[model samples]
Target: MKVTVELSSLNKDDDKIFGNIYFEENEYAFPEKGWNDFVIIILNWWAKSILKLLKNISIEEELDFMDGPASVKVQYLKNNSFSLYFILNKEVVYSSEVDVELFTKAFLKELNSLIRNIKENRWESEEIYSLMENYKMLQKCFIP
Candidate 1:
């Protein structure tokens, strides 16, 4: 499976993110208990870790998450009077904020850090991205 993230928004400071994960083989073929399940099961954990980083910066925020067939929203209120919203699911994932002044710098910094961590730890063990690569290659083989 291969997952790619795309960002779109009204401005460069606060934007929306969209993520799509493609599978090469049968959906049930994923090593993480087959393809019928989504990679989100693994990613959700990472999401929690990502939120922890903002613990000191944000407060009084509500994390409304729905582990259903729909989406999940994680909201964080920063000390600078800014709020960050992370809408994520198996098909789409994005982060944005309401306060420009508060989230502009912090949001970008946190996002960059999150991406870096994913890239670094992904190759260490049976990580989610590795499974995506396997799925992508497996699916590519069928293209011919």
Candidate 2:
């Protein structure tokens, strides 16, 4: 509802995004049976999935993603219609308030990208930062 990011990278499989996790955020929960089912599929398959796609979309849950020693927390903000944040360590590294409909669609698209990147062994590359910077332009459209 507030900000977003559109990313581009060399790989066809990547959305190249690095901020504001849409799927984890309650603020952008525009419910649809089809979409919910689709997310469940992705969660069931991704290498390091952060969601379980349970019924009712649990916003109070604190989800964390871990791969060996690395960890990232996906938080649920109760204020401002329940925004979601990605906290790295004790710092809030990424925060996004997305358009409910657009972000959901985008998140689905990006999930595939993430899977592809992970498969290609490039999920944590520098392109993520580039894409994050590129995505900052998204705020301009929504902030006004």
Candidate 3:
């Protein structure tokens, strides 16, 4: 399937950093960051995870985004195949074309591991705790 992830203006310009994933159709686009702030940092971590995931899946494609934070739309083939687009920095905006059940299972597993690691390490500094609380609050806007 052709999956494309477009970056917004908030992200930067990188001619050589395009098409870093395994997608059929390819294009250039911009991204934007919505309500939640510190999008860049959040996406930085998210991008790393995506890169690692894609490697594990043996998908070859390109990924491009501005140096800052931005929003994105992840699209794919198969007549509206599963895809995900969301603001990583802002409460994790997500759009998906994958199977909901499977995705949920995998996502929850990974998230649980991440949360457990954070808790075990006691990495929640005052500032980080503040951000985590804010993120939790932002999640309420969608989860409920």
Candidate 4:
């Protein structure tokens, strides 16, 4: 399965960022219509969760997109594999098995792109800075 993440439409004024996750044909978009989700909080949580997974410190992790009413629950399987359950409004929207290495690659790629976009747009904020710190930690510890 192909998994990828996209982040865009950073509204500095309202402190919201719009984004979507694509797992092959499955798509999960956040906030639906308004500026309700905080970009930094979501991204930081994701980065930290991924870090824990990489370190084999957590067998399961659940990421909740605050105010978006969406979440992703990741459960580790044997031999660098995981089960990903995408939830929307307390229901499972999609679920699939994913290779940990591939998922990490996709996540890191999108994260790099997000950092570049932030720099290019000059959209600096405290929240953004905190997220960057978390990203840095993730990068330092990531193996592949």
Q: Name the top lDDT candidate.
A: 4
Which lDDT value does model 1 have at 73? 35
Residue pairs of candidate 1 with colliding backbone atoms: 1-132, 1-135, 1-136, 24-139, 27-35, 28-35
Task: Give the range where candidate 3 is weakest over 10 consecutive residues by summed lDDT.
Answer: 15-24
TM-score per candidate, chains pooled = 0.22, 0.32, 0.30, 0.77
Write candidate 4's Cα lDDT for 15-59 as tens digits.
Answer: 555445434534443323333455566777888888888788999
Model 1 TM-score relative to the real fold: 0.22
| RMSD of candidates 1 onward, in order | 17.8, 13.6, 14.1, 3.5
- What is the clash count for each candidate, in the order shown? 6, 3, 28, 0
lDDT of 1 by residue, 1-144 (tens): 122222121111112212322212234211122112233333434334324434443343333332334332334444433333333344434343444333323333333443454455342334444434433433333355
Model 3 C-alpha lDDT per residue in residues 31-135, reported as the tens digit of each score: 421222333344334444443333344232223344434444443434423365544455434444564334333433333443354466454444335435443
Off by over 4 Å in 4: 1-8, 14-36
Candidate models: Cα lDDT each: 0.34, 0.35, 0.37, 0.70
TM-score sort, best first: 4, 2, 3, 1
Winning candidate number (TM-score): 4
Question: Residue 26: error of model 3 in Å?
Answer: 19
Q: After superposition, how far is residue 116 of candidate 4 from its true place, in Å?
A: 0.9
Residue-by-residue lDDT tens digits, candidate 2, 55-98: 12444434343211212233334432334454545565555554
What is the Cα-based lDDT of residue 72 in candidate 1? 27
- Candidate 2 residue spans exceeding 4 A from truth: 1-54, 68-82, 112-144
